[model samples]
Target: MLIPITREKFEQLIPLIATGPQYAYFWGKLPMVLKRLLISVVALVVIFLLGLAFGEGFYFFRLLFSIIAGLYWFWGPIYWASRRNLEIRRYKYSGFWRGRVLDVFVTDEIVGTEETVSNRGELVIVENRERRLNVEVGDETGFTTIMQGPLRRTHKGIAEGQVVEMLILSNQPDLGRIAKTSDIYIPRLNIWVSDYPYLQRVIFAQVSSQLSEAEERDYPDNRAVINRRRRR
Candidate 1:
C-alpha cells in the first residue's frame, strides 16, 4: 500500500533540498535592486556624455533622462524583487514530488508537421493520488529536437504500465490545473535525475554554503546566492 504525504511536510523539506547550479544561476544571484540601480546610473552617464558632446543646450533632455532614470531606479527594482520573492515563496510553499510518468498526451492531431509548436506539454495534473497540480512544459528548440530523436523512440518503446518519476508543483488539492511543473534546466546533469531527492539535498546545501560565504564577506546588497543569511 502506498502512503500519503502532506503538503506541510513537503514544505519543511524545501530548505533541505539542494538546487542545481544552473537553477541557482538563474534564480539566485545579485538582488534585482542593485542591478536596476546600475542600469539607471549607466543610462544617466550616457545621457550626460551626449549632452556634453552636442552642446545643443539640451538641458531639458538631460532632465527628462534623469526623470526616466529615477523612475527605473525606483520602480524596476521593486518589480523584479517582488517577482523573485514570489518565485521563491512559491517554490518554498507549494512544491511537491512524485514518481510517475508525466504523460504528454497529444490531444490535437495534425498532418505533415515539419515544424510544430503546440500548447501541449507535460501537464502535472494528478487527482487524489497525490494532489491536483498543473505543471506545463513548453517546447524549446533543444527540447523539441530531443523529443523528436532518440527520446521519442525510447519513450514509445517503454513497456505498458511502466512507471517513471516526475516532480510536480501545485496550489490546490482537487483541481490539477493550478500546478506548475518543476523543470530544472541543467545541461551538465541528466534532466531525468535532476529531481532526484538526493540531488535536491546537495543543491540546497551548496546554496546555503554560498550564502554563508557571502554573509561572511559582508557584501549584503550584492549577495545573490544567500537569502536571509545575516540571521542565520
Candidate 2:
C-alpha cells in the first residue's frame, strides 16, 4: 500500500541491530584495515628514506610523503570506520522488513561512472542523473512507515508503486527513524537488486532463492564500484 512519510508512521517501523565484528570503536581498525595501514606506512617510509639521497631535487617527494602520512594518521581510520559502519548497517538491512516503492525522484548531484572497454583503457563519464526513492514498509501489526533511500544508476527503470524491500536500522539511539537501503523486486529478473555495495549486490545475486524467481543478472552497468580499501 502507498504510504506517506509521517512522524507517527515512522515510529511504527522496526529497526534491525547489526550483529558482527565490533572493533575498538573509532580507534580500532579491522585486521585487514590494519594490514593495509601497515603496508602503507612501510611503503611511505621507504619512499621517504629514498628521497634523502636525492637532496633538494626530491623535495616534492618528501612533501608528498608528509601530506600522505598526515592524511593517513588523521583521516584514514575515520574513513575506515565510516565504511565499516555502512557494511554493518547493510548486514542489519539484510534482515529488514518488506516494503513497496511509493515514489522516485532524481537528485541534482552528478557522480562519475566508469567502464572498462574490451580493447580500450578505462572509460569514465559523469552521470548527471542520480535518483532517490520513498518506500512504504509495514510490520505484522500493519503499521507502516515511508522511508527514503538513494537510487543507484542500475535502478533507473524502477517505477513508482513497485514492490520494494527495506532494511532499516533497528537499534537507532540517535534518530527515531532511519532507512538504510532499499531493494527493488524485479519479477522478470526474479531477484532483488540495490546499489549500496557491490559485495552486497553479489551476495543478493547468489541468494536469489531467498528472494524471488528472477534470473541472475549482472550488477548495474556503468555504476561506480566503491572499493573502500583501494580508495585509501
Candidate 3:
C-alpha cells in the first residue's frame, strides 16, 4: 500500500541540511533568509565596483572586475540554485505519496560489509564482520529494489524483514502504474533509498542504534590461537 505524504510530515522527516559539506556548513549554521541576504549583499557590491570602474573609463580594470564578478554572480549562484531547486522539486513530487510494504526479497548481489578486528601481541582477535544485504520491496503497484546495503552499516547480523510505510511518485497513476525505485527519495535521510520507505527507515534507524553483533555466525577457538613458540 502507498499513501500520500503531507508537507508537515515531510519537513519533519527530512534532514536539517541536505547538500555537500560547503553548502551544508551554511545550511546548518545560517537560516535561509540570512543566506539570501549575504549573497545579495556580495553581488550588489561586485556590481557597484564594476560600475565605478566602467564610469572612470578604466577599460582594463572594468573588464577584469566584470569577469570576476560575472563568475561569482553567474556560476556560483547557478550551481547552488540548481541543486536546491532540484531537491525542492523532487520533494514536492514525492510529498503527496504514501504506501505500504507488501513483500521483501534479498538480491544476490552483495554491495559491501563492515568488520572490526582487535589484535594483541601474539593473538589476533577478530570481532564482527557484517554483510550488506541487497533487497527488493514489493508494493501494491509494483516492486522497488535498493542497490546498496539493505541493513544499516551499524547493524551487522539483524535479518529483519521489510514491513513499513513509504512514499512513491506516480508517473502515470491515472493508468494505475508507479515509478521505478531509482526515481524515489527517502525524505528521512534526504537521499534516494528506493521507492520503499519502510526499508529505508529500517536501515537508517539501524545506523543510529547501538546494536553490535558478529557478522559470522560461528567463531572457532582455533581461529584465535596464538603463534607462541620458544626460540630453538
Task: Give the top-scoring candidate (lDDT).
Answer: 2
Give candidate 3's total backbone clashes: 10
TM-score of each: 0.29, 0.35, 0.34
The sequence of per-residue lDDT tens digits that candidate 2 reaches over residues 95-132 is 33444444555544453444445445655553545455
C-alpha lDDT score of every prediction, in listed order: 0.40, 0.44, 0.39
Predicted structure 3: lDDT: 0.39
Please write out the lDDT profile of model 3 over residues 1-232, one tens digit for every residue: 3444444544444433333432432343234445555665686577677677668676666567556654553345445534543454353433223232233344444333434444544544334333434434445555554444434543232222323334444445342454533223322334333312222343433322211112112333433321110000
Best-performing candidate as measured by TM-score: 2
Model 3 residue 79 CA deviation (Å) reads 4.1
Mind giving the per-residue lDDT tens digits that candidate 1 earns over 1-232? Answer: 0112354544443433333433343332355457667888898888889889868788888889888986785556345444443464464224222222233332222211233344686444332221121212322221110111112222333321222222344555532332444333221122332212222444433443443464558866756533322222
List pairs with backbone clashes in candidate 3. Answer: 1-99, 1-100, 2-98, 2-99, 3-97, 3-98, 3-99, 4-96, 4-98, 5-96
Please tell me which model should have the higher lDDT, number 1 or number 2: 2
RMSD of each: 17.8, 16.0, 18.6
Root-mean-square deviation of Cα positions for candidate 1 versus the true structure, in angstroms: 17.8
